[model samples]
Target: DIDPELKQTYDVMNRLRETIKNRDWPNYNQAFHPLQGCSEEMLAALQTLAAHHDEIGNTFTHHYTNGPLEGSNNKIKVIKRTGFGYRNFFRFRLRVLFAFRVHTKRALITK
Candidate 1:
């Protein structure tokens, strides 16, 4: 038997999928209409996006979360204190990117 939480998530996913499959256009403030004739193509694209969403969501949940990024920002503050602050935001950004490239690459590989 599926857990209650998983069942709820599946229901929500199905609703969203149906909405995408049926919607005439990406409009706002109206109920989405079923595309009617293009169900196959619509559903195929939607299913592909859903699968990618699940993959990315799983990666975000299991690794490379915002927690570590925030922690590194805190650590950067300490580094700034010692280095008398990085006045060039671009250089600072590159430094951070370079430092984290290995970890990000590993995460992408594992994912």
Candidate 2:
């Protein structure tokens, strides 16, 4: 059997995940309060999450998200890494633009 403390920690984590997934902002505090003395490490993680709770909840409150912006950033990073030999800033900028243009064209054609 697993240790009692470990089981408690897992239970708390599962509840937190459920609360976030459901966007139950009203019961967020109640969901998290039980973690207060579960374990020092768990409590510390909980504290950090609580500190950024608003930013976290913003995902639920706002219909829009920065997912596309983050995907674009990842694509740019890939292009830069794969074409690491390019030394000119202008050339790099053009390459990024070209890559994006190709991507857009493919997306439009597939639609």
Candidate 3:
């Protein structure tokens, strides 16, 4: 079995994660209010989480995310690195745009 302290810490953190995911403030407060003398690492983490409580709450309140935008940026950066052989800057730009702008499926024609 894990050390009791470690197990307690894990239980507390797991409860915290579930409360955050569910946006249950009452449960979160119950789980978080007793962090007085946990291990030093947990204390530090608690401080960080306390400082960002509003931001963390905001995170759970919104379903929107910048994940897709970050993915697109990563794709563009990779293309930029490997596209040096393009004849010109505009041509390279076009290639990148085409990669993103092209339709995966053609439209049906019914005349």
For all candidates in order, the CA lDDT equals 0.53, 0.79, 0.76
15-54 per-residue lDDT for model 1 (tens digits): 6656545542232112223333334555565557656865
Task: Return the top candidate by TM-score.
Answer: 3
> Could you tell me how far off, in angstroms, the CA of residue 106 lies in candidate 2 after the best superposition?
18
RMSD of 2: 5.7
Ranking by lDDT: 2, 3, 1
lDDT of 1 at 51: 66
Model 2 ranges with Cα > 4 A deviation: 85-91, 102-111
Q: With candidate 1 superimposed using the best TM-score fit, by how many Å does residue 69's alpha carbon deviate from the native?
A: 4.0
Model 2 agreement with the true structure over 1-111: per-residue lDDT tens digits: 367778788889888888888888777767787764377788888889889988878876888988999999999999989997688876777777787875564434421
The CA lDDT at 17 in model 1 is: 58
Between candidates 2 and 3, the lDDT winner: 2
What is candidate 3's local distance difference test score? 0.76
Better of 1 and 2 by TM-score: 2
lDDT of 1 at 63: 45
Candidate 1 similarity to native, TM-score: 0.27
Clashing pairs in 2: none
Top candidate by lDDT: 2
Which of 1 and 3 is ahead in TM-score? 3
Q: Is candidate 2 or candidate 3 better by TM-score?
A: 3
